[model samples]
Target: MTPLIEADGLGRSYQQAGEAVVALSPASLRIWPSQRIALVGRSGSGKSTLLHLLAGLDQPSCGKLAWPTLGPVESLLPEKVALVFQAPSLLDSLSVAENVALPLLMAGQGRDSAARVAFALKTFGLLALVDKLPQTLSGGQMQCVAMARAIVGQPKLILADEPTGQLDQLSAQALLDALFRHLADSECALLIATHDPVIAARMDIHWHMEHGLLSCGERTAGSV
Candidate 1:
């Protein structure tokens, strides 16, 4: 099977008040098409740093990331890759449906944007609230709207950074279940950063980062 994403010796660092902080250590990783990989780690463990790199939202300071790395890479397309933030990133200024259609519009998409937005809203059971403002929804409902926004573009890769962190247990589980089920039926691959072992245990594989170093299998020893 072709690995949809590959990071070879990928590294990232930041300058915080003139002090260098190593956000991600040089690490190699791969995920095949339709693969669901969980990333578990404690706070400050570099999970979010890695998710950013994988999603092509940010580039590595050193090393390389190849798209469709495992096989048949035809072309590298932008927006075909997506990132889901921990918080509901919906625009309070736009209605839920309009918020969901932003990416498509940004990509210069046309009339079908409305249809695609409706489909995404239906998937997350947010169709009834399509005309509501983001600020009016409950936390879980807000996040559902955010998710509908993420998947409405037909992305091939989805990178989630503790997407359920702000959600209640029931809501978190429901969203995760829906996301994984989507991956199973579609050709997309997901790499998620999370603290929930209940969700991690259901993953195809997992990676734990510690002090900017990538560790496979079990989490950083003694991690929560």
Candidate 2:
């Protein structure tokens, strides 16, 4: 079967404090539909950088990155990939529903926006908080809202960077469970960059990175 996203010989580098630092080595990966995987690494281990490349949020310093396929025949633009950062990354002024609906609304999908917002709220257990502001919610709740907003547009792929990084243990587990439940129901391929062992243990596939190189783990039952 064709892969939903692919990256070949992908690498990224940035100059920090007068030193050229390589954030990611030459790496290649493929994510098929409905797969839930966790990318594990300590800070500065290239997890976020690889996630950016996978999501097309940033271009690789070298190699090819693609959606559905890895070439010009039909490579998806950044808009087709939904990214959820460690921070909520929500608009400070927007209401919960408005923020959740922002992507669809931007796509000229006004009629479907309301329904999408409602469904997302229900999924995140935030139905009553739809009118609340981001400032009023706890870190966990805010992250849920952000996750909903990310998926509202129904992109083919979802990339997350340490999504549960800020929450307590229980809250983090709840968030991961809700996220995996949603993935079980959607076609959105998942690539979550995380360091939590609890969350990493639940993934169908797992990869660990050190010095910018990722080693694939033993395949679990749910891995593609």
Candidate 3:
């Protein structure tokens, strides 16, 4: 089967005060349909940087990247690949329902956008807060809303960065349950970046990141 995304020695770096600072070491991996992957690392370990490159949010400084099954990089968002950031990233002016509906609207699914948004919110137990604003909700609620937005379009892949950082254990588990339910029997794949060992254990594949380098299988000693 064709991989949803494939990266060959992909890496990123930044110029810091006339010095080259490596954010990500050259790393290669493939994300297949229906795959469950956990990117385990501590803060500043390049987990977010790698996710950004894979989601086409940041340009890689080296190696190659491709979306073999999803399509071109420019056309991979809000339709083929969705992102849930560490922060909630909701528009304060927009209601919860509207926040969740934005992706569908952007994808030109305006006709049934409300229905889909409602369904997504319901999945995250946010249906009652549909009319609420971002500032009015708690941190966990906001994260749930962000998750609802990510799934509203039913994209092929979801890349989440530190998604459960602000949530309690129960809330985090509930969110994961909802996400897995959405992925069941579908081509959708999930790749989550987290420092939680319990969360990492839940996924089928575990990848480790440290000091900008990436590796599969057993995690490195003293990492995350």
Candidate lDDT (C-alpha), each: 0.78, 0.78, 0.88
Q: What is the overall TM-score of model 1 with all chains considered together?
A: 0.88
Worst 10 residues of 1 by lDDT: 69-78
Residue-by-residue lDDT tens digits, candidate 3, 168-209: 998899899988887787889999999888777788888988
Clashes of each: 0, 0, 0
Which candidate, 2 or 3, would have the higher lDDT against the true structure?
3
Give the candidate order by descending lDDT: 3, 2, 1
Query: Pairs clashing in candidate 1?
Result: none
Model 2, runs deviating above 4 Å? 69-79, 220-224
Candidate 1's C-alpha runs over 4 A off are 69-78, 218-224
Model 3, residue pairs in steric clash: none
For residues 24-137, write the lDDT of model 1, one tens digit per residue: 989988777777778887889899888777766677898988876523332323357777887668788999989889888877785789888998888777789989988888
C-alpha-based local distance difference test score of model 1: 0.78
Give the TM-score of each candidate. 0.88, 0.89, 0.96
Q: List the residue pairs that clash in candidate 2.
A: none
